[model samples]
Structures are given as structure tokens and as C-alpha cells.
Target: MKNVVSYLFLLFILGACSSTKEKTGTSQAEAIEQQTIRKIDVHAHYRYARPYLSSFFQDWIMQAVLVDVAKEDSTGINRSWKQYVDMDIENPGVFYLCSSLVGVGIDDPDFATKNIERLKNEIATGAKMVKVWKNFGMVTKDGSGQFIQIDDARLQPVWDFLKENGIPVMAHIGEPVQAWRPLDNPMNPHYEYYKNNPQYHAFAHPEIPSYETIIAARDRWIAANPDLPILCAHMGSMSHNVDMVAERLDKYPNMMVEPAARFGDLASQNSDKVKAFFVKYQDRIMFGTDFGNYDPAVDWTAEQLDAEQKDLDATYNDLWRYLSTTDSLVIRKQHTRGLGLPREVLEKVYFQNASNFLGLE
Candidate 1:
């Protein structure tokens, strides 16, 4: 009886050891998978720097480019620009800059020249790329009250300079096609935005340029600068359909795209189809979260900071899972299946492609 009891005790101890080993092995595997590849967010607008921000990037093995835009309200432009530049300086390899030209003087004869000088100065100060915002096609107007389209003849000099210097442009020229449709479907990723910002709701504002007009002008600008490299921010504003994006990608070999702030739209589509799209354009698609506005002056409590970190972790993890796994997941309150993309595709989409485009390789 004593011998049998001792043997039972030994079996229990061995079982416990096996379970512990299994758990540890699983954790180590997960850590290895998560940290194996480096990532770059090609589009972001981090206006201010915070002390805790570095940890987020380090934890994810990621870097980002802080994009600057010349908005109509210039009250905080200088301050914000300095903040971004300082952030890039502070975080040497972790942060980069993408500068933009002033849009307020598009009608002036010297607009292109002045912007060229500004861009040169910005490039000297460590700008890796230039950004042309939607203001060119949507907001900025000429002396005669006509909107200044992106393909305007006056801006040819600026494009020429970029092309000559081998600098890429990040063009965010138009709103999503859903902007032209009514806000009847809450499921649309852009429904809330158009509902809140009625000025940009093209269906309501027929006076503004139609969606087709803006997209055509953007295409013309792109085609005219065949030698120039252009990264279409926000899936070329064609997030509504992967087919449309593919068509553009096929048409313009000099162009690439980053799906900033449009992950929900991708998630809304059939997962298999989207996965195929990524596979087909694996070399051209890059990752961008559009995450920004890390101002520490808000006096956030420890609890708030903790909650914010949790949210950030979840966001990154969700995106990674969607791209790298085949698990069923809920994204933005919608049920969707993961892409289960191959490791090679993920590597290119997450880092390799962006590195090549930004010349960080």
C-alpha cells in the first residue's frame, strides 16, 4: 500500500511539471512571434511628444513618421512643427518627419517657388518626404473663387523639383467615396465622420467638386509625374472597395498605398478577398495606424494613462492578429475573420515595403 501511494504522488508531481513546461513554451513562442519583425507606420500626426510614448514603440518594435500639414489655422503651426521636429530629434531611429508645404497661398504666382524653398529647408532639417493634403483639391481656392486642384499648372514646378530630387510625395487628395453617399448606413466606416462634418459631405454640398472630379485630378497629377514616387495615404481614398484600389495600383506603377484609418473598411469586406488583395499587392501595401495626438499636458491620471495604454495595446494586437492569424475576431464591433497572411507578406507590408519607400533600408 505504501509503495502504491508513493508512485501516485510521483505521477502527480510529474504531471505538474509537464503542464508548467508547456505553458512556458507557449509563452516563449508567442513572444518570439510578436517581436521577430520590426515595423514602420508610414503615416501619423503626432503633434506633441510625451515621455511614455517611446515605450509603446519599443514594445511593438515599431517606428513612425510624424506628418505635418499646413492647415488654414496657422495659430499653432510653428509650435506643432517644432514639437514634431524635436520629437524626431529626441527619438533618433524611432521617429521621422514628413513635411508639407503651405496651402494658404495657392493662388499666388510665387506659391510654388516659396513652397519649394520651404520644402528644401524642411528636407535639410531631416524631412524624409513631403505631404500634399486634401486642401489642394477641397479647400484652397484661387482669386476667382475656383478651387485649386492638385494638377494645377502652377504646382508643376513643385512636383518637378520633387521628381528631380528623387523625393516621394504622400498625397491625401480626397475623401472616401462614401462621402458622396448619404449617411443612412451606420455600418459604413465613414458614416460618423460625414455625419459630423457636413461641410465635406459632398452629397449635401453640390457646389464642392464631385468625388469623380477630385479623383480624376489626383490621377492626372500622378500620371503626369511618372518618375515621381507617390505614397497614396488612406488607400488612395478608395477604401470603399479593394477592386478600385487594385485598379489604381495596376494603372500606376510608381504609386504605393498605406491604409491609415481605414482598417475598419478592410475588416468590413470579405476577409479572403482582402487577404488576396494584400497578397497580390504585397510589395505595394504598407501599414499605417493614423494614431496621433499624444499630448501629455492633459494631466491624465494614472488610471487614464493605464486605460490608454491598454487601448493602444489592443489596437496593435488586433491589427496584428487580423493580418497574421486566421482566428475569428471582432473588430470595431463587427465579426470578421483574420487574413492569416503568410509571414513573408506580413514582413513586407509591416516593414520591408515602408523601409524601401522611405529609404530607411
Candidate 2:
């Protein structure tokens, strides 16, 4: 009886040890998998450096490009530019800078010269790319008060300079096609934006150039500057239809695009078609969330930071699910199926392509 009791005790001890080993092995495997899932957000606007933000990037094994827009307010633009530069310095390998030249004085005779100097200075300070915002075509006006289109002759020198310097341009020249349509459709991803900012709502302002006109100008610019690498931010503002985007991609070898804020538009489309699009143009597309406005200057409370982190976590998970699985999911309130992209394609889209574009290791 004593021998049998000792035998039972030995078996219990062995079983417990095996269970511990299995749990530990499972945990190590999970950690390794997470370490391998690296990503790069090619378009973002994180203007301020926060410890939590850095922690979030490290937690996800992700990197980002802090893009600046040359808006009407030079003071705000300068502040944001300085903040982005500081953020890049403070968070090496995690944050990259995409600098923009001021579009406020395009009509000035020394516009190109002055802006080129500014860009040169920014590049010396670690700017990897330049952003040309919608103000180039829609908001900026000339000496005669005529809206300046993107392909304006006066902008050629700047484009030439970027091309010569081997700096890629992140061009956001127009709004989505929905910006020209009525805001009655809640399904449209841009409905809320057009509703809130009526100044950019082309539907009400017929005098504004049409969508077709702006897109044509952009196409012309791309064609003219064949050597310049262009990352068309926000699906080149043609997010409503992947087919339109593909047409341009097929035509322009130097042009690439990031989905950014257009994931909702893609989600609204047929899943099979979207998946096919990704596979076909796997080398040309990149992942970008258009996530922004993380200003450290704002005295955010602990609750606000926590809420923001939670929201970011949810958004990243949703985006990952949409890209990497076939499970049915609701994105931006629209029920849709995931693309179920192959892992290799995901790697290129999520990391490699952007890294190659920005010349990062």
C-alpha cells in the first residue's frame, strides 16, 4: 500500500511538470509570432511625442511616417513641422518625417527657389518624403485669384527638384468622388466630411473645378514627371472605385498609393474584387491609417489617453482582420467580408513596400 501511494504521487508530479512546459511553450510561440508581425504606417500625422504613443508603436512592432500639410496658417504649420521633426528625433526608427513646402505663395517669383531651400533644409534634418496637400489644387489661389491646379507650370521646378533629389512625393491633390455628390448617402465614407466642411463640398459649389478636371490634372502631372516616385495618399482621392485606381496604377509605373482613410470605401466594395485587386497590385499598394492629432501640447487626462489607446487598439485590430482574414466583419458600420490576403502579400503591403519607398531598412 505504501509503494502504490508513492507511485501515484510520482505520476501527479510528472503530469504537473508536463502541463507547465506546454503552457510555457505556447506563450513563447505567441511572443515569437507577434515579433514577426511587423508593420509600417506610411501615412500618419502624429505631431507630438508622447510616451504612450511610443509604447503603442513598440507594442505593435510598428513604425509610422509623420506627414505634414502646408495649410493656410503658416504659424500652425511651422509648429506642427517642428513637432514632427522633434518627434522623429526623439523616436528614432519608430517615426519618420514627410515634410511639406508652404503653398501659400506659389504665385511669387521666388516660390520654387525659396521652397527648394526650405525642402533642402528639411531633408538635411531627416525628412524622407514631401507631402503636397489638396491646397495645391483646390484651396490655393494665384495673383489673379484663380484656383491653382496641381499641374500648374509654376510648380514644375519644385517637382523637378524633388525628382532630382530622389525624394518621393505624397500627393493628396483632390477629394473623393463623393465630395462632388450629395451628402444624403450615409454609406459614403466622405459624407460627414463634406457635410461638416461645406467649403470643400463641390456639390454645392459648382464654380469649383470638377472631380474629373482635378483627376485629369493629377494624371497629367504624373505623366509629365515620370522619374519622380509619387505615393498618392488616400488612394489618390479615387477611393470610391478600386477599378479607377487600378487604371491609373496600370498606366503610371512611378505612382504608388496608400489606402489611409479609404479603408471604409474599400470595405464597402465586393470582398472578392478587393482581394483580387490587392493580389494584382500587391507591389504598388501600402497600408496607412490616416490616424492623427496626437498632440502632446493638449493636457490630456489619464482617462483620455486610456480611451485613445483603446480606440487605436480596436482600429488596428479591425484593419488587420479586414486585410488578413476572411471572417465577416463590420467596418465603419458596413457589414463586409475580409480580403483573406496571403501572408506574403500582407508583408509587402503592410511593411516591405513602404520601407522600400522610404528607403528604410
Superposition error at 256 for model 2 (Å): 0.2
Query: What ranges in model 2 sit over 4 Å off?
Result: 1-35, 73-79, 294-298
Q: Can you give the lDDT of residue 250 in candidate 2?
A: 97
Q: What pairs collide in candidate 2? A: none
Whole-model alpha-carbon lDDT for candidate 2: 0.85
Ten residues in sequence with the least summed lDDT for candidate 2: 23-32
Off by over 4 Å in 1: 1-31, 74-79
* Clashes per model (N, Cα, C within 3 A): 0, 0
Candidate 1 residue lDDT tens string, 248-351: 99999999999988888888889999999999999999999888775655787878777777677667777888888776777665678889888899899999
TM-score of 2: 0.88
Candidate 2 steric clashes = 0
Q: How far is candidate 1 from the true structure (C-alpha RMSD, Å)?
A: 6.1
Every model's TM-score: 0.88, 0.88
- lDDT per model, in order? 0.84, 0.85
